[model samples]
Target: MRQKAIPALETLMSAARTIGNPYLERAKKAGRKIVGVLYDEVPEEIISAAGAVPVLLRGTGSDGTELADPYFRELTCGYTRHTFNEILNGKWDFLDGAVIYNSCDHMRRIYDNWVRRPVSPVYSFIYAPKKGGELARRFYAEQIRDFLHRTEERFCVTLNEERLGAAIRLHNEKRRLQRELYAMQKGRRIALTGTELLLVMMAGKSLPVEDYNALLRKLIASLKSCAETFEPGVRLLYMGAHADEPLFFETLESEGGQIVVDSTGFGEQSCELDVREDADPFEALVSYYFEETPAVPRKFGTAPARAGHLLRLVKDYAVDGVIVTRLTMCDLWAFEQYMLRPVLEKQGIPSLELETDYILQNRGQLATRIQAFVESIRSSRGS
Candidate 1:
């Protein structure tokens, strides 16, 4: 199994690198509807329960945003523009339906344009509450039920609790496998590159759950024979927005900075919690999203709590430094970095913040920053 990991990783990375996912193609071939989701906090189990596959409509690291320029203003985040560009280029025509939830102004704009243009056969925007509490949870539960009901009605299928439970279980298994893989990296028992780990996790959103789990199981079994030694690099934690593609990590690690953990929606943050099976799945699912998931936009005024989670990862992964990245116009993560950086700095965690677009436009500049960051870490350790 270990020996087979190279090809499996490549396949997953390729799926993630491409515009439409390969597993999505497989699911389509199997006569399944593929519903495209935008970002985090949108529970995909609902889609899976409705007998459809949920594929996250991630952006391509395309060179230009000319296609989306007319639809969006200049101030729109590049991530959204890049995705819209891909949509206009006929990249996501494989989707049967789309679920868009509110996370920021950029995503809302994406929803607006997407609905008017109609890439998928059906498109709906689900309201997501920005705060957490009993009132919020109750409201979110209602929203989840409404979304589920809408999906069922739109597709003319019954999403009974049994099917939902099965989907939840399958998703949980995938999360468990991911957690195990991260643990191996954390313990220095396996040498999984940050870019590779991220690709595998991103594949989970694109690949069928069962296929991802099988590949993960094989990868984990393969890592068992590996030696537990700290990999040669400046161990780092990446806190950012949607870094689905490998370019960001590749450039950052092109020098000597090795990311062991990340807080992006496409990274460790995606699998932070699991839906409960004992109680009402809807209630549990809402609770997990509202209470357990550490989304910065949703947990405003809770910097200490959020910082504590980052600190925990810092300690767990033995991270030497932190890289805080944000899409050029992503206000949520920009403000998040502002709020969290002070907390981390007080604890002596060296961090560098970079604002970039989806594409690797300024590799020379980013590589220089990464080289400096890595050297700073080494200098501080020597001191």
Candidate 2:
């Protein structure tokens, strides 16, 4: 039964890699609209309540940004550039509408470009609060309310309390199942690699919430029943930057380092906690997004606390080393890495920094660096 489930999990990964997922295609056939989400922090529950499927518009590994050069500056992050290029090249023309959140300056610039050019028929820019407090929470709630109102008006649908409750329940199940799957990585011997886990998490958001939840339940059960342990080299926790592709993880592991956990949005930050089912759904969403989600921009000035969080994961996962990856020209991750270096060094944890774009143009250099890093850790262990 466990062997029978591998192909099913691979199907979801393929759907995620494909721009239009199976559920989204089926929904379009039935005349349901698709809402493209720019960032992870956006309340997808709101989009679902508006009778639309929320699909995260992430970077493509094989695409270039040459067409997007005229619109954005030379130093624009590659992920943003590639996504914009896809829009300009008519790759994402199927999206009926888009909901963009102010996750960072690059994302906001993408939103600005879309507003100036108008890719989707309808658009909504949501300003997520950067800090946690009463005022921030209330402000976030108002933003969500506005988003819900605009979506309903655009789609001509009424998202009543009952519909909203159902959406919450569906999304909450996705989160719960993801947490259970990730829990398999807790001890020294685990069932899945970090790359596999990252793809599963990414694909979970790509498909419909109910379908993702069902598929995840099956995968988790298969992993629990399987007895194989991936005994690679030293255990490492990948920190910093958002990676939509698994090439980086593959490269790191190729050099004898097994990534066990990650600090990126695709890992522990991918809504492990569930939204309250009893409370008002919108308010619960606001609390879960603003209060629970941890992004680099939100913890800008507090690096020790962030590094301390990574340290806790190190202890929890029994990590031998860490690799902090930053996308070229990403100021947020760059600055965060600068702050996290000394903290990790003080703790005596081995760490390495890697810089790359969305595409794998310099694989040889990255492999060389990773091999050396892993060898150094092994040498120190023998000492």
**lDDT values of the candidates?**
0.79, 0.78
Candidate 2 lDDT (Cα, 0 to 1):
0.78
Backbone clashes in model 2, listed as residue pairs: none
Model 1, span 1-383: residue lDDT tens: 13444666677777777767667778899888888887677888888888888878767656678889999888888888888888877788888888988888788887888787733454567788887677877888888888888899878999887888888898889888888878877865346878888888888888777788887887676667545334746888888877765777888888877778887786787777667879777777777776777756555566777788899999998888999888888888888889877888899999999988777678899999999989998998893
TM-score result, candidate 1: 0.94
Highest lDDT model number: 1
lDDT of 2 by residue, 176-257 (tens): 7777776778776777777777777778667777677878877777677767667657898987777777677688788778
Off by over 4 Å in 1: 1-5, 118-120, 226-230
lDDT at position 338, candidate 1: 91
Worst 10 residues of 1 by lDDT: 1-10
CA RMSD of all predictions: 2.3, 2.3
